[model samples]
Target: MRKYALLISLLIIISAINLNAQDDNEKQLLKQFHSITSEEMSGWLEKLCSPEFNGRLSGTPEFVASAEWVASKLKEWNIKPAGDNNSYFQWFKWPYTIINETGSLTLNLRLSDGSVIRKNYQYPNDFYPGMNSGSGEITAEVVFVGFGVTAPELNYDDYKGIDVKGKIVLMNRDVPHTDPRNPEYKKWVAYCYHQYKLENAVRHGAAGMLYVDGASANPNITYDPSIIVCGIGPQPLEDIFAGIKTTNKALIEKIRASFKPASFNTGKVMTIKANTTRVNEGRACNVIGYIEGTDPVLKNEVILIGGHLDAVGNAGRVVNGALDNGSGVVDIMGAAKALAQSEIKTKRSIAFIFIGGEEVGLIGSKVYTANPSFPVGKSVVFINLDMVGNGTGFYVSAGSSYKEYLKYFEQANAKYIHRPMRTAAPEAGEYYGRPRSDEVVFRTAGFRTMAMWTTEATKKVYYHLPGDDTDAVTIDIMEDVAKMIYLALTEMANDPEIKF
Candidate 1:
């Protein structure tokens, strides 16, 4: 009986020790969580938006400088390098284009009295100079080519019965089969690229292109010295259909309903002029660093978190991408610093990637996926953050098939940072549509992927525009996101049997 009593007392003492250890861990986590502040995040954002970085366009000297700055911070925080040759960068060849100055777009109206009335549109609002246009001007009649697709196998061709030779062709972005889950959308995916559209327009003998992409700056188009291009806004589009009996909206709807072509001549003469230079030998890189885990066996498994650090550069003027991705980069930086400073050690490795060349294309992600620092099969999951700094609440999305991976972030947000959160698990068919984000590249490479997005934005978003400065971001939310990621990622990495 005395021996039994002794055993019971020892068990009680062990329980008390475990409880105290848990308390200590909680204290340490809270310390790091509170260390993330809005002021610090704002300061980091300001530096990214500074004029010296030249808007952080990849394949430029300014972009390389910005990447080096980020790598220096990782070194300061003691995050070990996991890139090529034990350095912090994975290099790749990324040819880029520079728009020299704001170009001009004029609409010519021919009157019955043998006089022409010319209307010149304003910069950025009515028209955006093409990022990859040739250094010349073209004057031709406008031909409306719907979506600019020609899939002979699918029995569809937008350029059929249309004479666009030596003419300016106005085209939309994507194919007509809008539903992504129908499985037919995948067939049209090859034609959904901006590069493909530009090339198709060139192949059709068009002299120039007026892309109808919301008049926003797009750097994803291919560079061809034979053609000049520009993005047109609502004013110009409306003017193109001024006297037509049917509206542009009606024509698109009719085309979608019956897989037929609605090509026509707008009878409008327009002039597009651009001055640009293309550098074929430009190069870019991805900034990569990792925190090695303590456990011998579990350390092989890695959790990757990344955000793009490249913006649209300057379209005659600097497009400071503060809210576009500066917020995401700084948010990850905050989490990285806290993780490196924490006393507690995770069982699985954690990697922080500041992806480059995302604006021109998904080049950075492609490079990393092609030659991963760690084995791709050993990666547990990838978390991507883009434009996550201008909202009232939080939103998390993952493939609906993988509810286990989603729970880690969901539980973290629910337990600690109790903001209005919405979680989505979109099906694989509906989720993986276009190759738009970095997550797409990772997902296509068979890596489990999830993304964090902000909801209910409080301010106007200046996507790929000059207004996307530090003021466009909500610093408070960014701080919270950093804290949340810091807590969740550490906990996830420490788990020995994390199911994907």
Candidate 2:
């Protein structure tokens, strides 16, 4: 009886000690969380949007400079390097293109009096120079090709019965199948890529392309030496379809109603010009850093948080991607600082990666997945952030399967942040979706991925345009996102009972 009483007393004392230690740890964590402020996030966003980074185009010297700055911050916080050769950089080949000037797009209108009227489209308003367009110009008649897709197995060929040889092709950005929720959408997924569309136009002998994606800078296209490309807004599109009986929307709906060819000559001659210089020898990297865990066994398990740091470069103008990805990078930086400075010790390791070349392609993520700093099998979850600074609330995806892991973030938001938060489960089994984001790349590489986003936009979003500047960001939400990451990731790392 005496021995049992002694054991019970000992158990009570241990529980009291653990409770007090947890209280102290929570106090320290709160201090670190409070350190994340909107003022600091605003300053970081300003610096990222500044001209010194040259829009942070991957494979450019300015991008390397920006990467060096991020690495310096990690070093200042005493985080260990988890990159190549004990450095904070995982190098990869990422050649880039430089649009030298604001290229011109002109519409040639035919008059009945044997005369012609040339309507010139202005830059950034009616047209945008393609980021990866081949140098020089091409003057040719425009042939409207629906969606620029040619899938014979699906009985859909946008190029059939149309002779686009040595002519310009006018096409939209995606495939005819627009719904992603349907199982049939997977059949058209191969044709949804910009690279595929441009290459298909080239394959059909098109000399130039007028993509109907508005006045936005897009770099995710294949550059062919023989073709010129430009993004035409609604005005030019309207001009191209002026005499046609159907509108662009009506024609697209017609084609989608029944998978058929809607190819036709618009009798519109347009001039597409661009002077872009290609640099094939450029290199880029992913900045990776690590914080070792205290427990020897759990230290091998790594929790990764990453965001793309590259954006659309100067396509005639600086596309300050302040909200697109600068928000995400800065948010991760704030979280990293808090985690590194906190007094609460974590049981599992944590990694921070500033990915590059996401604008051009998911090149940095591909490189990291192929040659991971830590084993992918041992990773807890890859949390991705992109365009997370413009909204009033929080959202997380791929959480339903990882409910045990997602609870920490939910707790953080409920206890401290006090924002409207939501979560989504990933599609079951393999992801046969479009290869558009770094999250998709990681998911394809067999890693469980979770992504953070802001909801209910407070400002107008200028996607891939010159107006994607600092004004588009909501700094208060950004600060909250950073704090939530810091608190949630630390707590998750310390929990020993978490399962994959």
| Reference-based lDDT, each prediction | 0.89, 0.89
TM-score of each: 0.96, 0.94
Instruction: Report the lDDT tens digits of candidate 1 across residue range 273-365.
Output: 998888888888999999999999999999999999988888877888998899999999999999999888899999999999999888999
Question: Predicted candidate 1: what Cα RMSD to the true structure?
Answer: 1.8
Q: Give the TM-score of candidate 1.
A: 0.96
Off by over 4 Å in 1: 1-9, 427-432
Candidate 2 overall Cα lDDT vs. reference?
0.89
Question: CA shift at 66, candidate 2, in angstroms?
Answer: 1.1
Evaluate residue 217 in candidate 1 and report its C-alpha lDDT on the 0 to 100 scale: 82
RMSD, one per candidate, in order: 1.8, 2.6
